[model samples]
Target: MSKRLYVGNLNFSTTHETLQTVFGEFGTVITCTMPTDRETGLPRGFAFVDYATSKEAEAAICSLDGKIIDGRPLRVIEHQERAGRDHFGPGGGGGGGRGGRDRF
Candidate 1:
């Protein structure tokens, strides 16, 4: 099965092509994505890279974790899927608030 990795602490200027080139050295990259802020349309300083196999993914994690790219150390790890979390619907994660009340 394919493996997905979470790549964090990325430079704002990092691109998908750059990730493909760098990560491809270890193994075949099936897919790469760099998310952006919805409002500002700026790079979110993180990305997800999918490898064709878990072995390739582990190789990348061993070699590239903490490797500096664009002056920032990358945080590479196996991506874990959250269970039973519907983020697209209401009450997804809007918990823990004062509910318009103040502690005076």
Candidate 2:
């Protein structure tokens, strides 16, 4: 089956095409995407890669996890579903303890 990989610690200047090119050596890149900030439209310092197969994904991770790209160390791993759920009842998703008084 195809695998999705998470790449972190990316340089803000890196683009989806750059990532696709880098990972393309390992295997066919189905798609590569870099998350961006909504307002500033800047790289969020991470991205996701979808490879044609799980073996390809593993190979990509092994070859690139600690490799430097654009002067930053890349963190490549199998992407897992993020653990963020709606934990708050009202104003949701802020930093820090969930039960803390709103001081910000």
Candidate 3:
């Protein structure tokens, strides 16, 4: 099964390509995502990397965790799913607005 790993304590200048190149040493990197702030559009100093297999993910965690890159040590670990949350974020769907209530 594919595995996702969370990479934290990253430098602000880290790029998606840089992550792939670094993590690719262990195995195939399925995807790399670096989240940027909505307003400033700057790197959040963290990233998520998905490997083609669990073994590949493990290899990366073992080798890259605490490894220094760009003057900062990396924190690599298996990604955990947040309870009661999805890609769109928390809460159970329908929100905002007056729920069809006539505001007169």
For candidate 3, which ten residues in a row score worst on lDDT? 84-93
Question: Model 3 — TM-score against the truth?
Answer: 0.80
| Model 2: residues with Cα > 4 Å off, grouped in runs | 87-104
What is the per-residue lDDT of model 1 for residues 33-75, given as tens digits with 9 covering 90 to 100?
A: 9999999999999999999999999999999999999999999
Query: Any residue pairs clashing in model 3, and if so which?
Result: none
Cα lDDT of model 2 by residue, 15-57, tens digit: 7778989999999999898888999988899999999999999
Error of 1 at 6 (Å): 0.2
Give the number of colliding residue pairs in candidate 1. 0
Every model's TM-score: 0.81, 0.81, 0.80
Q: Which pairs of residues clash in candidate 1, taking residues 3 or more apart in a chain or in different chains?
A: none
Output the worst ten-in-a-row residue range by lDDT, candidate 2: 89-98
Q: Give the range where candidate 1 is weakest over 10 consecutive residues by summed lDDT.
A: 90-99
> In angstroms, how far off is 62's CA in candidate 1?
0.1
Off by over 4 Å in 1: 86-104
